[model samples]
Target: MISQNTISQVFETARVEEVIGDFVQLKKAGSNFKGLSPFSDERTPSFMVSPVKQIWKDFSTGKGGNAVTFLMEHEHFTYPEAIKYLAKKYNIEVEETQRTDEEKARADERESLYLVSEFANTYFQNVLHKTDQGKAIGLSYFKERGFTEDTIKKFQLGYALDEWQAFTDEALKKGYNIEFLEKTGLTIVKENKRFDRFKGRVMFPIHSMSGRILGFGGRILGNDKKAAKYLNSPESDIYHKSKVLYGLYFAKQTIAKQDNCYLVEGYTDVIQFYQTGIKNVVSSSGTALTPEQIRLINRLTNNITVLFDGDEAGIRASLRGIDLILEQGMNVKVCMFPDGEDPDSFAKSNTLTDLSDYLTEHAKDFIQFKASLLARESKNDPIKKAETIRDIVNSISKIPDQIKREVYIQECSKIMDISEEVLFSTLAQIHKKDYQDANKKYRQEQKAFEVVKNEEYAKPKVDVQYELERKIIEILMLYGDRTEQFEDLVLKEDEVSGDLIMEPTIQKARVFEKIYLDLQEDEMMFSNEKFRELYYSIIDKLNQEEEFSTRDFINQLDQDAASTITGILMEDEKYGIDDWERYQILPKKKTDTLDQLVSQTVLSLRCFLIENKVEELKNNILKDNVDTKTIMEDVKDYNDLKSLLSKKLGKVIGSYVTK
Candidate 1:
């Protein structure tokens, strides 16, 4: 467990925008920062971070919280892991209790796998630097590859000793469980016998975007004719190779800053570029590109420059992957080295200035490169030439933006010497077929579910009572200590008509006092347990503290309560300033109409609950042996109160009428 004092220091020191800025690219929007939602695939910016509030909200996904919650949501970190991450980022010393053996045994399996993988990373690094055999073999190989000591240590490159049990034995002696070792694929166990998976190989630890060591990719140094040269950790709970981009942990901020990402094919390609001072590059680790990996980059930037080996035979096949990049609506360019050169070797030979210039000069628009390459293949064959044009058109259609698609189509027409009309027709045909297929799928789904599409399967009813209670909580959190003028509705007997009429009486009280007294008078409690807990906690803090800081208050609560309060507090900052300006929408604060806002919320809650009580009475009257007179009288009294409440909230959304 992390000590409360250390957690407080982390919360006090870590800026929400600064911590999140490491992973997300944010631009200033008035007093806040806006960026693309890291939790969802989106083109427009919907994620908002408020520096003043010390909170963030992803409008697209409706996930909002402080810095710690962002880590928990984005990285799937345990609460303690997030606190530790923030502590490290802010350079705060974290005070933690030692985990006992019983606690360790009951810990999460995924966390155990993380522990085992981390231990393996540390062990491998020790072997590479401390052992004579490792220095002579693994260190020499890295040095031969032109990697500096700083770069080697920065990437945490390491080696596993040649002996089969070298790693397994050391790990076992250290109290690392064999089950987790096998699960992380660091060790292979068969019939209780263990062997190091990457024996005799140099290790490159693969990390998640949050810098957790997920697995390893090892390169065998010596000539083994039958063994595969490069081996990766088997797909484990903690690592998915297809979804992991090599060097992203180190490259994320740079990619966002550069407004572009350099795509290479191997780990060395990324390291070589990064070592040479180009920090905005990542590799696919020699696997085929995946949409998940592309979306990861999408969270950072929308432009990619793919660096291909000059002599690669599969360059044409790799073009399919670049098309996936296009499908994500990104601007993609292709660059090639001189024949026989890959990014690693080319960067190694050229000066940094020369390398940067070469990349800038050689990078071609993906369409232009595709057109030139395919046209060369067509030569004098008319049929192949027509097919090349169609292929180019299909790639253009994958772009989600119509303007970009049209622009690329024009470029294709000019490059291929084909008329724009022909290309546009082909693009239209592809879109039409896509629409038809989608429509057919929708029709099939509707037909399959038609029998179940009765009133029972209709849209779920919105819970109005919950909303009313939520509004009360929102008011208490936002303006609890502040005094507001309220209008109390008092039922008075009309002297002439003898009918009860509501008379308004002006009163002044703190927001919390008004809400507490109203709830106490009604003898009501929040039906939602989370809301009930938060309501009392907020009231207690307000009454006791001299100064109530929302950020400090959030820091003291548990995860669920903090997230709920943060969501309510920062909900108004969802739209970027540019959006507000463009839409010409000026927002009115709840404080501006505090009198009506507070009264309306309380009255609405009363009206809703009264209707529910009346409903119960009606249900009781229907039973065979119930006394109808007393129940009818109770229902009549509820209706009278509801009618008075209705007169207050009838004009707004709080109207809760009878069934």
Candidate 2:
């Protein structure tokens, strides 16, 4: 466990823009930096980083938080991982509290796998440098591939020795459990024997976006006719190949900055391009491109230019990935090398300037590439050409942006020498079919969801006190520590006569104290359990401390409570871009309206509670023949109290009764 002092130090030292800029490209927007959201696909920037507040908000997805939270969200890192990441970025030493054996044993399975993967990565790298066999084979292979020593180390390239039990033996000797070894797919356990999985292959450690080793991609150097050329770590708790793109950890910042990503097909392809000065590139590691992968790229940039070898297979590969990119609302272009040249070979053969020039000169938009490629096959055959047109239209329909679709339609019509009318008509039919299919899926999902929801828990009916209770909690979070003058109507008992007299009193107190006293005087309690708990917790903390730290308060909460409070605090940022003052529509600041806001909120809550009491009394009056007169009197008294509260709020009694 990291010490609280260390965590606080890390939080204070880490600047939001500096930390996030490592992963995102942020351009100056007024006092804050704005960029495309890392959580969603959008061309116009909706993501803002506030250096002054030390926080960031993505309006597109409604995710906002401090630096640590950003890492947790964008990198899917655990709290500890995010803290460590920030600590490293800011050069702060993390101080740890020693954990007992039992506490260490209680660590989760996923974390164990991560630890094992990290250990294996270090072990492989040690072997590659320390062992003569690794140096001769793995190092030789990487060097022969034209990868510099720095590049090799940067990518953490390694070698697993040919001996079957070499890695398994070392890992077990180091106290790593065999179960975890097998779980991470580093050790293959048979009936009575255990052996290394990537034996004799040059190791390429694949990392998560946060730079944790999730898996490995190993290339076999020795030519064996029957053996596969490359072997990747099998899917495990920590590694999901479909959700990860190779070199993303290294390429994310550049991809965001360049406003484009270069897509390739293999690990070496990515390495070669990166080594040759193309930093904004990633590879599918030979798997067919998935929507998940495209969405990952979409988070960084809206544009992708796929680099393929000048061969039939490479062209087919580019064609396969284009629609997936289009479906995610990204701009895609295709660039093919000279005859028989892949990204790896071409990059090696040409200078950086030459390769860059070639890519710039040859990259074609998806529409043009599709038309030209399909046109060759459908030469002079009207029916084949018509089928090709539909194929193109199908791709166009996958585009999410209507404006982009129309532009592509215009381009496709011009390229294919086909009428825009026919294409639009085909597109309309396709859209109708898609809508029907989507509606059918939605209905099925809705039915399944309804069945589960009904069985587990019924939907909550709205309580009138909900909003007021939430508002109180919000005020306590936002202004609980601030001292303010409060006016109250209190009934005081005369010391000698023992008679109570009502009077107005004024006192200065902390906002939280005033709210607590006001609610206590009326014997009011929160209706929501979560909010109720948070309210008490806030009061307790305020009583103990002179000031409240919103971030600290949020950190002490569980995920649900923390999320709720964060949402409430960040709700105001929704209008951040509106700049109402610029249009002479200046709105009252919360500080200026604090007194009215608090009074109105409290009054509304009292009225709601009284209204509930009156309703209950009216219900009782209608229910029984014996107590109708008594219930009617109780209802009238409650209504009178409600009217008094409304009058105090300066509202006409009968006119505001419906509220």
Candidate 3:
């Protein structure tokens, strides 16, 4: 377990914007930072990070929390893992106590897998550097590829011995569990006999964005026609091939800094580019580019330059990735090298300046690259040319931004000697078809959801009191620590008879204290359990701590309560500053109007409770045998009180007459 002091130190040292900015590209927006939602697919940014509060909110998906929660949600890190990550990022020392053997045995499956993967990575690196056979095979192969020792070490490149049981035996001898080793796909077990999966191959460790080893890609040195030349770890709990990008850990910072990512095909391609001073490059790792992978790149920047070999296969791969990038509302460019030269070869042979110049001079926008490539193939054939135009239009239709789509359409029209009008018409038809198909799929999914819901109990409906309770909770979260002078009604016990009586009093206290005491005096409670729990917790913290920290408060709550409070606090920030003015709506700033806002919210809740009582009184009057006169008197008194409260809120009360 991580020491509390270390966790607190991490929380204090880590800035929400800086910690999140490592994984996201953030642009300044007034007092906060805004970026595209890393949790969802979004064109315009809806993710907001407030450095003052040390929290972030994704308005698009409604996920928000402090720095640790953001990591837990975005990167799927356990609480300890998130703390450790922050500690490393901020250079804070993490002091942990050793776990007992029983505790270690009871550790969760995912953490065990992570430990196994880390051990395997270290073991492979040791083998490549320390063992004679590894140096002879793995080290020599990397050296032959012109990879420097520093580059090899930076990427954690390593080699596995030729013997099948070399790695598995060593790992088991180290007392690492067999279950995790097999689960991580580091060891293959057949009929109770286990051997290494990547035997006789050089290892390339694939890392998560946070630099944890998720899996490995191994390249077989000796050619065996029957065996696959390149092998990747099978899918596991922590590693999904489609979602893992080669060299993302190394390239993420550079990618965000440069505002562009260079997409290549293999692990060596990424390494070569990084070694040649082009650090912002990643690979699809020989898999077909996936939407998940595209979204990963989109998080850092919306600009991708796909580096391709001059071979036909490379051209085909570039074409395949272009549409996916465009669909994600990203700008894509293509750079193809000379014939028979891949990124790995090209980067090795050329100087940094030469390679940089070649890329700049040769890189072409996707539309132009596609048009030129297809136009060359369709020379003197009108049918083929018409087909190529349609193909280009199809690519253009996938673009989400209308302005970008129009720009591409015009470019294609000019390049193909076609009219812009004709191209626009084609795009419109394609969009219409796509819209119809999407609607159809949505309806089918909705119907399926309805059927499943019918088989389960329906969720309880929320009452009006729920919103009122939520508003109160929101007030406590936003302004609980501020001192306020409150006129409150308290109950006093008579000394002689011990009877409780109401006493009107005024006190200067924290807003949280005033609200809590006021609620207690009224004998009122929040209708929602979550809101009630959060309210009490906030009050308890305010009473105990000298100064309240919103970030610290959020950390102490469970995920659900933390998320709920975040949604409420960040609700007003959803609207951009210009949006209100543009729409002719002038909302008062909460900081400037806190006193009025708090009083009004409290009055609103009281009025809602009074309205409920008034309705109950009327229901009693409708009963056949009830005391109508007494009920009428009670109703009149409550109505008078409600009217006075409504007047205090700057609103006139409507008549309560019933037909």
CA lDDT scores, all candidates in order: 0.87, 0.83, 0.86
| 158: Cα error in model 3, Å | 0.7
**lDDT (10s digit) by residue, model 3, range 507-537:** 6878887677656644777778888888888
TM-score per model over all chains? 0.92, 0.86, 0.89
Error of 2 at 351 (Å): 3.1
Candidate 2 lDDT by residue in tens digits, 84-194: 988887789999999899988988888889999999999999999999999999888888899998999999999999889999998899899999999999999899788
Model 3, TM vs. native: 0.89
Name the best candidate (by TM-score): 1
**Residue 282 displacement (Å), model 1:** 0.5
Query: Please, what are the lDDT tens digits per residue for candidate 1 over residues 1-659?
Result: 78889987988899999889988888888789998888887878888898998988888887888999999888889889999999998789999888888976778998899999999999999999999989999999999999999999999999999999999999999999898999998889889788989989999999999899999999999899887889999999999999899999999999998899999999999999999989999999999999989988987888999998865567887999999999888899999888888999999988899999999999999999999989988999999999999998999989999999999999999999989998999999999998999999999988876554567558778899888777887888778888887766678999999998777688888888888988787698888888898899889988998667888888777777877877776666775635676576776655667767777788778878888888899999989998899999988988977786687676333322221
Where does candidate 2 have its weakest 10-residue lDDT segment? Answer: 650-659
Q: 1 or 3, which is superior by lDDT?
A: 1
Clashing pairs in 3: none
Q: Could you tell me how far off, in angstroms, the CA of residue 197 lies in candidate 1 after the best superposition?
A: 1.4
> TM-score of model 2 relative to the true fold?
0.86
**Alpha carbon lDDT at 528, candidate 2:** 90
Clashes of each: 0, 0, 0
